[model samples]
Target: MIVVVGITVGILDVCELGSHFILMSITIACGMLSEAYARGPPAPNASTHHSERQIPFAACDIAQLLIALCWGITGDIAEIVSRARIAQLWAATGVAVAYMSIARWLGNVIIFDRKKSRFVANAVYGLAFVPYATSWCALIARFALAINGAEASVPDWIIAIVIGMFFGFTGTFPIIHALSINRVIDVDAAEVAYAIAGVANKSLLGWYMWYGVNRMQTA
Candidate 1:
């Protein structure tokens, strides 16, 4: 339902940068939900070791990765059709996909491996935010150019970069609660944390972009 509503909102204003970000974010939220459900049915026999029951979880992770790639491509399509090529949008999308794939692999390693390194796991996860931040920065820069013409100056770029970092931090930081794997912490708690981060990254970020665009247009 959230995905449907988000996509609908974007469709209503397909040309808007805010709409594109909103759509991409919402799809990401859905992908997060897919990741949360990676665990499958219990083994039918008690003799079946947990290590042997890897197929279902692996499949679900793949599904989540595919979901991310699809939505990333959707945003790329929007940029290609509706907006100027200010950011080399496809390259950003490709980078995002690549980073996310690596992050997913690291996540699995952290989850299943006995020698999991939390620092490496966290680093990859944090790095995944870069593409989104760059895209947001590009959108803001494009907006400034639209409003200020050739007069869009250094301060404008600085402000956009700052705003992009703010969004990136707010979106990615909370997911650390999930990424920092601990045997003592409840798995459900981690899922809840992830869901919260999804809301911050997707819905709240989208709202801020929409509000900023409206303010800029009116000013």
Candidate 2:
């Protein structure tokens, strides 16, 4: 739950810029380390252990699992942040539903699994920012809320643009695993690109989150 840890750390005194960057670098390093390990020669499958041990990563893999766990924790932290914006939640949900509807139609009408690559599925999953969009979706909802005596904040266009890119890159996370996409990773150095993108997205979201919080507080 590195995410949970990160988010927890974020809430714990708002994380000064330097400390936050340091922790974020650690997070990226975790991803890189995990990638390096996965790229190492694949070990033979051991069937002796129960629980359908397809690939032994239990005790053998410490860093990867720890990172995963920490990320989960960060999600918990984000949820805490989100709970403060119920109006944004509703607004983001609406946005997601509407956006997905149109996306589904487009997917069906065109680009409907032309190649049908598993990697593509994973990449699409990486792009899908279901809840994270709330950071901006809430902003949109705030504007809408003002329509009829509803208290809301001004829609900051700058933050929306920034967060949109962040959310877009956040989606590419899964496919970034160099080990997972061997061919593309080898040819395109996509893993490195993904690593860079991941950090960028996180930083962008961080700014968006902090900006929103700061503005709302002062508003």
Candidate 3:
């Protein structure tokens, strides 16, 4: 709950990690106050580790920061084009993967509800990857522009949606499946569904999606 709420706060603003911590403290303090005032029975299960494990709080935080930092690269693509830039974008993504791995490790080691970790972490991480992908798209667009010149003409919003949906599908859906929806209990059903409609569907669909994104440049 706290982690999800914190992530939600972060999503609302780029500077939310700090704000989330502060907000959490205030909320905890208020909850304590309310508990103290109650003259009747005890409060709810406040003793349990949130998600049933010791969340790699620092690790998860670092992951979010790492992700945000990777996103910061979009700001530098132009410099990259004319200067020294390598196709090391995967490195940026790796940092995020490590963090997510840490979170999962925390979940398993601590006996946290695996399901919870699956959903929240997936949603957060998957959605998070979009900016990084966008950075690449922008870099690509810049290169295309440089070659073709004259604006090369394109619609950014379309690119935004394609990029957004790509990450959303690639990252989010599987996580939602493995974690939140607990698809393992119904493997056959999941396969049928994913085969026909899920992201597991194929690269052509992905390419189609990417093509739509390219149209953004002309839009």
Q: RMSD, each candidate, Å?
A: 16.4, 18.1, 18.4
Per-residue accuracy of model 2 over 1-219 as CA lDDT, tens digit each? 333433443443132334433544444444444444444533356233321222222332333333433343233233323534432233222222222222222232122222234324433454445445445444433333333233322333333334434433554443444333565333222322332333344434333433332332233
Whole-model lDDT, model 1: 0.40
Candidate lDDT scores, in order, read 0.40, 0.35, 0.34
**Candidate 1: tens digits of C-alpha lDDT, residues 79-191:** 43354543224323432442343343433333443333433444445555556545654554454345434354555444434443444446453234334365333333233
Question: Highest lDDT, which number?
Answer: 1
> Candidate 3 — worst ten consecutive residues by lDDT sum?
195-204
**Candidate 3: tens digits of C-alpha lDDT, residues 8-91:** 433432332344235434434433333234322223664554434333233443444344334323322322333223222322
> Model 2: residues >4 Å from true position, as ranges?
1-13, 17-22, 34-40, 44-117, 125-136, 139-219
Clashes of 1: 0
lDDT score of model 3? 0.34
**Best candidate, TM-score:** 1
- Per-residue error (Å), model 2, residue 20: 4.5
User: How big is the positional error of residue 33 in model 1, measured in Å on the Cα after superposition?
Assistant: 6.4
> What's the residue-level lDDT of 61 in candidate 2?
31
Q: Which regions of candidate 1 are displaced past 4 Å?
A: 1-39, 44-70, 73-120, 123-125, 128-150, 172-219
For model 2, give the 10-residue run with minimal summed lDDT.
Answer: 48-57
For model 2, what is the error of residue 1's alpha carbon versus the real structure, in angstroms, after optimal superposition?
A: 9.4
Clashing pairs in 3: 52-112, 153-217, 154-217, 154-218, 155-216
